[model samples]
Target: MAAPSSPPARPVRSRTSGPWAKLSTVALWMPFPALLWVGGYAGAEPRLFGLPFFYWYQFLWIFLSSGLTWCAYLHTTPTRPVRTGAHRPADPGEGLR
Candidate 1:
């Protein structure tokens, strides 16, 4: 009986400094409190859908950030190739099943 050949040895990958730093900074700082201040200030005195401007303005962002975070998470998520190529599958039966 023939034995299966050894698989390719994967090399360790250290995190790159530039893109990760830029991404982390942008990700962490993008949705900060000053943003709320800017948003509230911009939307002040603007009534919408029968809701007062000030009250609605702050709440608008609650929904907005939820969606934004979902999108950001999606953006950060790995695609088929990137994930599959990165490391071995978590479960042994992943490939066959």
Candidate 2:
């Protein structure tokens, strides 16, 4: 009987290691307060383009949250070295499965 070989070990990265990484994690939580606590800021005092403040505020967050997510992605993503043609996957369909 042949023994099973273990997969390659990946380097461990701390979630709060660097400032950028910590900011990236914090960016993800930006939307929770505004969206989750509806009654906290739900009011019809101010208006925008015939829309109520409550409505427009949430609608504006759609774009703002998207921008924040993009910023987090840019900050957290690591730059990898370009691979040469010499290095190839062990199996042609390795990732397909």
Candidate 3:
């Protein structure tokens, strides 16, 4: 059997953790206006291959935003399941396997 892991990884943060994380997160959203303006103009330029530019632009984001938000959300989340057989520590006193 494999050796048990050390304690669950503890996230460490300094005093600036809050402001830094929040600032960067909020900053990521700050680019929407420019994307909209440019996307709008580009999308407004009639259809491409029979799809309207506006429609295409918005449609593009349907895929883009889902991916972006998913990426961002995952980024903020903690480590996920590992493919190996290892597992997280359970309730105290649970005997080691």
Candidate 4:
């Protein structure tokens, strides 16, 4: 008879410790409130490069959101240690093995 399999292992959780991680998480949520506040920037009085305030305000946020996302990625990602002592193999194929 076939042996029974053991239960699957739990997923390894990444360490998200530190104030930077917390701050990054908060930064990720900033775009939500900024975009949701339609009443604040809904007016057409303030024109940006001939575009109405409502259109330009949302368009400007596209770049702002991208920047915020990049910041969060930098803060939350685990950095790898630089391999200073390691040398590349003379034959690139040897390293693959």
lDDT digits (tens) for residues 1-97 of candidate 2: 3434545445644444589988887888989987899996598868899888899989999998999999988777765444334444579996587
Model number with the top lDDT = 4
Model 1 regions more than 4 Å off: 1-28, 34-44, 81-97
lDDT of 1 by residue, 1-97 (tens): 3444555555544433556545754665656774657654664466788777777767876777777666655455544322233446579997797
Ranked by TM-score, top first: 4, 2, 3, 1
Model 2: runs farther than 4 Å from truth? 1-16, 82-97
**Evaluation by TM-score, superior candidate among 1 and 4:** 4
Residue 90 accuracy (lDDT) in model 2: 78
Model 4, span 1-97: residue lDDT tens: 3434555554544537788789998999999999999999889978878999999999999999999999988778776544344544668897477
TM-score of 1: 0.44
Model 3: per-residue lDDT, tens digit, 1-97?
A: 5756655544543433465457547655744863668644564567778987867776776677667666656556545533454555565555553
Q: lDDT for each of the candidates?
A: 0.59, 0.77, 0.60, 0.80
Off by over 4 Å in 4: 1-15, 92-97
Q: Give the TM-score of candidate 3.
A: 0.46
Looking at model 3, residue 91 earns an lDDT score of 58
Which candidate do you rate higher for lDDT, 3 or 4? 4
